[model samples]
Target: MTVPRAWWARLPDPVIDAVVVAVAVVDVLLSLVDASPVEQAMAALACAALVVRRRFPLPVFLLTLPAIMQAIVVAPFAALYTLAARSRDRRLLVACVIMFALASEASWLLNDLTSDDRTWTLVNFFYALAAVAVPVLLGQLVQARRDLARRLVEIEEAREHERLLHSQAVLTRERAQLAREMHDVVSHQVSLIAIQAGALQVAATDPDFKEGACTIRSLSVDTLDELRHMVTLLRASGGRASELTPQPTLADLHRLVTTSGIDAELTGELPPGTSTTAQRAVYRTVQEALTNVRKHAPGATATVRLWHADDGAAFGVTVTNTPPTRPSLPLPGAQQGLIGLRERAELLGGTFESGATAEGGYEAILRIPAGTD
Candidate 1:
């Protein structure tokens, strides 16, 4: 089955079929000595049938039975091989092989009468069966080889697709982290610079000093705007770069708690019309806290509370988890979620705090001014 390839493998289908038919004709001619007109016609039919054997293997093989009955083998052998190579039904192929062996001995079986002849016929039947089995086995081997080649190609394609998805996921994570750092650190610092420059410009007595401070404030404000756009683009990196998804807000908190994969309850609500940034900070704080509960405190129940503090100056979210009921795996992590959450809160003029509670539980809280954007 692993034999070196000959030049014939590269031949076109039409050319190969032409060659097969020509060879089958030559075989029929060589075996046609003293053959009757009916036998000659059947042999010619078998030779011609080889041209269409690839497309109609079973029928072509049946067409060669008459020639096989007249003791011609080459045409029948080719037809049986075609049948076995194309057919997927094992029972059908086995039946065809039996039919082929019977056809090869049909003339002798019809005329035999003597007991000695009967014994010889049985021996010839098995011999014919053995001979016909070679093509069937060879045809099956070729089928198996073709199937294996196709399977290997499919596996390689699947692996390539998986690699592409993995690389995309990595790129998305990196872009999101970059966006967070830019929004939380660079934007915050630039805003402060702009605010102080404006303050200095208003207070400066000299005309030159006032002009310089005003120029600095303008540039800082422009840079801060550009950074915001960049952060938006980076956060939306997984899809269209310019398109941004709706940022999460306090209204989404209930759904977040339900889907956080923890036994959690939500208890309080902030007044409506809070700034979008403050709402987002609250949402992220709860999301990160619930994630930690699932990861480090398996089987722990949690409570997420949203409340406006006394004096009505600020609102906040507090997420607390009970002690874990089951041990947790020591899963490796970058430990960036809490840090990111804290940075996000500071960006909104808020505070983030997390700690192990007195009862061996965990708590995370984010408080932001109600009026801040």
Candidate 2:
């Protein structure tokens, strides 16, 4: 079992009270030697009361008051000290003063029970009052110091939290700046490519070269459309994580197939009220798969299939394409499309599968949980 944490475990309160408990025990012993058995009993009771004085300060102090006639009293001082340090009301201070006088007089009377000296008793009485005052004064100082320490801790914590928030704000602004720079630079370059393609289409007389230029122009327009969408996201969110725009969903797969200029078929059905995230993931998967078909299989036909679990807990997309017609369009760089798609699926607690079929065709499959609202 875990131990309960004590507030005073790291504090002087425990150490100070430990020594005081020891002193009270010693006083119990001394009273047995110097005074009557009745006095010794009272002293022992006072010593025992000291054990809980810290736990039950005011009550223990008040209980110790009647026993003060024989009180060698260590408990009362400890109790008064606790009260002084913890209590805020002025009424308790007045009570402490009155109780302190009573305790002091008791201590003095008990100290010289057999003495016949009146003037000396008064002097001893004053001495006892001074002794009681010491802990009260010390307790007040300790309380003030503790309050100051607590305030310092709160201030430091607030400052640390503020610093972290400021650092995050700076990082967000930097990311948005990087996105803006990329939008400006890449958009300019793509626009130039589109212009050159348009010029080539106009200047060229051969049908073959003109067809190539038109394809180039089409691809350029599509790229610019995707780029503008991204740039608008960066501007809107101003953060690393982009807020979703109107991403193409399963419903838009027909448009995607037409744009790919491929012989294609789509089948199966999307569940009613499918989630936005699942819809986006399905669209991207199909889009990327169709792009792959265009690049690697050129004139070959592709089929896209989408389905939902009977219980409406999961939705899926599968894109498969026939083998290449011949040597096709060259694709550069590492192909991160399917890898990125797999990550997106897994992040949503879903799955992705892709491989070449026995028929010499390639198939890419993605499944994502259609979580309820």
Candidate 3:
């Protein structure tokens, strides 16, 4: 059953109790006109007990029995309804119904034990029993309705969680498809360009033409290398290890520096037992810094320093390049690599810094917490 959001439904517990007690008091006043002094007092007591019916439903129902005998039924019916609504025992409710019916006819039974009208009294007792069942059924209906409402809320929340997971799965699949397209189409085209450049470099007679062809081939090859790494990252399945290949670390740094096409020196070493994550961060920092040196400062000489600082509390890498000996060509770049390096360092509870040195050189540094693993 749907719950009401009406003003009365939202009323506070104390206000609801007060309204019920007021109705019961009016009921007692109406019944007491023809009742004896003791019956009147019992009816008042029953009306007062309605205020606590929610907290002590069974005991309050018992207190209203005397009022039932006195023909003050409003309070007794209210108490019975409260007991049925709050209780989970069907057998207990059935017993309470029988008890209420008997209490309503107790005076008749005691005063006319040998009367000829006992058969008619029996009919009246059955009638009262049937009437008492109305409140009990209504109370049980309300209780079931409340339980169903709670179940609906839980079902809605579960559906929302499932929808979120579904959206994430769809997004992951799209990224994987895009990565495949880049590797198949884009990388293939770049590879063709590089092959053509190599052929031209070998066949050209002019010295300047051969140098130009070599530069084109070099640029195309570098583009392919960067694309391969990008595609691999896009296709990663969010596991502890890559499904396709291993990521770069300090072990790969020597090869990176040597093939970077710049005059650079590798020096110093990180302490043993350094984490793979930190090693990757250090590697990327050096890689990005050197790429910057090559793009913006041609013919520059660089130094790569890997160090353990603060008595092994931290470990980091530093790359510094001297001023360019030759002017650099205008290269298209968005500076996204530096941003990525900074974000990676932050993930490992570390820091990344890059700036121009006083001697007209550029410097980049990455420091990671030692506990990062």
Candidate 4:
């Protein structure tokens, strides 16, 4: 129940208990009346028990039962509130309330107030009812609010967990795609280079040139072997696999425009000799960005810009597309394109940014370390 974090949360347990105890002590002294010494002792016990009511709620409730039946002032009301807040057993709370009401009537009837004291008994019954209900109701309300807050927290945690699972699934699919693309594109093209080297090695009649061609062919074979092993060991997720094709580089910018079946323009230039890895990343960034434009903003004319210092210190690629005039292409989308592109750039010690442009277009940019081939 919400007893642990009730309104008295601001006050330490001992301090709140001291306040309650002081109130009960004052209440007892003010309401003292002619009673047997045994009843007086019981009332005193009830007042003292209020200090430990929260710690031992059930025991305190039992201890105060006699004092309540004897009408020992506010001790019984305080006990009832503590019990209602900490305990989930409604039957016990209801039973204690009934006992309190009956005791209120008995306290009046047993007095020497006269035989026609029915009206006074009724009024006292209502007062005792208020005392019992106000605390119990207040405690229950706090309990309900605490439960609601806990449930909301749990729901938010569940949502976060689901998002993580989805991310992991996406990562698995992307890894498989990488393996497939590397095997189908890189290994195949390298095998073609090896075949040409093998032909040159046999055709050349010079010993030095033939030996160089043989060396190139052997290196290509070794690379193909390693690439095949890597791809074979990779785990593939269940998704639509694209047909393996040659990986594009900066040289294929025009082909990508034609491949995307959209009006596109490209300008600027990378450093004279950038690393193959850096070039491939930029090409994929632009390719995916254009594919996204085709998917989300159909009929949008796109512009691709490349920038790099002649010294090859750093280079950047940017693609911006004007607002689409028509609806997007009717192809399914997974929305992971920009996310993957950003990851690719950052993995290479570069930065990537994509957002709506001030001129009412969308732009994706990537900056990576400039290195020669």
Candidate 5:
């Protein structure tokens, strides 16, 4: 079983109370030589008030003032020191100063009978001030240090929050880039498979059926080989030099549209090496726009326009398509894709905007600054 302990044992409150009571009794006994019972009783009570100085410092000081005046020689200066250290209000400090000054002057007046009494009285006043100032100065120093430590902790927490936000942003961008790469690889291969399958189905009875089947098999094998090689390269290079492979630049817009089963043409000359960031942004914008077409605008042809100038210092890509007549499949939410595209472009110091055209077609426009390339 555990044992309980008294509060005083942990905090020394009872011991402090006992010390105050003892000092009051001693002061009362000493005052009996020249003071009456009422004066002695008042002095003893005032001295005992020091035990609650931390909680009621101003009240205790006010209560002790009468006793101090009655018997200044036995005024319990120790209680005054306790009051000064415990209280932080400037009013309390000012009160203490006034009291000290009065006590010094009073003592000087009483000891003016001797020839060198002025010197002795000044020395005694200085000693009393020292007793009160030492404890007050220490308390102020401790409070100042604690305030400084708290400010430092707040600053460190703010910095840590900023670092976490930065890390999350970087991780999000990398995941988007990975999604674009996977879309390019998988979409191109799947389109080829669908085309070969259609051709083989129509020529089943023809003499060249076997040759077409062989071609389909070879295409599938080639796709698998390329996927394996890309995965191996990604693992070996550890994602850093993985970008060494030519990313789908403006030149690849035609292939992207064809793979999406859309008869689209690229107009205007496109910029070259428009920064990895810009290239990735343009690729993702086109990839997402085409995927939307495949899912929601099946059998609808699209047009893509790429414009570049200033020696590849600026570039823009826009894709637009009319809605399909047949019932379209539900496309992914436009808000999410647009948000991701906006983030990608803003990160590369660019802009992206997409909306439905007045003619019932959807249009996506992306522009990037190539100066950062």
Candidate 6:
């Protein structure tokens, strides 16, 4: 069988009360040589109230203040202890002032009946003041410490909230960037697929129609593989802890132009890592330009020029296509392609401009800071 411990053993309230009562009994016994048993009994009651000082401070102060006037040895100190332990609210302060006034007056009155020396009365008055003020001062210090702790906790919580908001903003921007890349890669490939499929369908009665179909299937498989690789790279590198494979840089512009229907010309030194941003930007720019060409400039040849300067400090891309022989077809409304390219350029603190050239050709120029990569 398990035995339970006494509640007072854990709390120590009972032991504290016992000690206070013992001291009060001893003080009462010493005062008995001059005072009555009734006076001693009142002092004992006041000392006992000290045990519950923290719980019922005001009541203890009121009960003990009058008793200390008759038996000054034990009751006054116990009342001072209670006053010190209680909070410095209006009620507690008021009670302490009243008790101090009463105790001072009582000391003067008692000393008048005994030896009436001015110096001795002054000494007793100082002791009475010290007893009352010390406890209240200690309580104020404790309250100040608690207030400081609360402020520290609030500051920590505010910093945590700010960190969370910053992280969320970064994640939101990264996801938007990823969506734009995926759109550029997939849309450009799909446009080529549509063109090849159309060509195969038109030549269905021709002898080489089966070979064109086979080429379309092969291109489709290659497009899917590139899409999967890009997706894996984007997702893996998105996290801080994940290691990612090297991605295609500006060096891969030749492959990008060849894959798309545009003929590209490189003029200056292309910087490293600018390829990812440049590729996405140039790809989307050409993709949109080609789309406009097919819709508005059929049979027009598109020319692309990529240049890097400032020792790879900056890079620029230009894609131009002549106007079609036939009348212009009505184009679709503004969509993700142009908007995504503009966003990508803005992200790198770059500029994107698309308009009609003097010779009836549509042109797009993207100038980006290579150091941004």
For candidate 1, give the lDDT: 0.86
lDDT of model 5, residue 303:
79
Each candidate: how many clashes?
0, 0, 0, 0, 0, 2
Which candidate leads the pack in TM-score?
1
Stretches of candidate 2 above 4 Å error? 1-19, 66-73, 106-127, 183-185, 206-219, 236-373
| Winner on lDDT (1 vs 5) | 1
What RMSD, rounded to one decimal, does every model reach?
Answer: 16.9, 23.8, 22.9, 21.3, 22.0, 25.7
User: For model 3, how does the per-residue alpha-carbon lDDT over 250-338 read when each residue is reduced to its tens digit?
Assistant: 89999999998889999999989988888888888888898788667867899999998857788899899999865344556788999
Residue pairs with clashing backbones, model 4: none
Instruction: Report how far residue 151 has shifted in candidate 3, in Å.
Output: 1.3
Please estimate how well model 5 matches the true structure, expressed as its whole-model Cα lDDT.
0.66
- Select the stronger candidate by TM-score from 2 and 3: 3
Candidate 1 structure quality by residue, lDDT tens digits, 45-137: 899889899999999999999898877888899999988887778999999999998888788888946999888888999999999999999
**Cα lDDT of all candidates, in order?**
0.86, 0.75, 0.87, 0.78, 0.66, 0.65
Best by the lDDT measure: 3
Query: Which regions of candidate 5 are displaced past 4 Å?
Result: 1-36, 65-95, 104-115, 183-373
For model 6, what is the error of residue 295's alpha carbon versus the real structure, in angstroms, after optimal superposition? 59
CA deviation > 4 Å runs, candidate 4: 1-10, 33-39, 69-73, 111-116, 229-373
What TM-scores do the predictions have? 0.63, 0.51, 0.58, 0.55, 0.41, 0.44
Candidate 5 — worst ten consecutive residues by lDDT sum? 235-244
In model 5, what lDDT does residue 35 have? 83
Q: Candidate 6's residue-wise lDDT over 1-373, tens digit each?
A: 2235567536677777777668877776676677677776677677777777778877777767766676454555655555554454757675676567556667565655545566666677667666666656766665565554544554455468669979976985696478457757774676578577766766687658766776776777677667767766665655433244344445555665566544434444446565465666665666666655554564577777777785767787788887654333344466566677788789879988888889987888888886665
- Angstrom error of the Cα, residue 27, model 1: value is 1.1
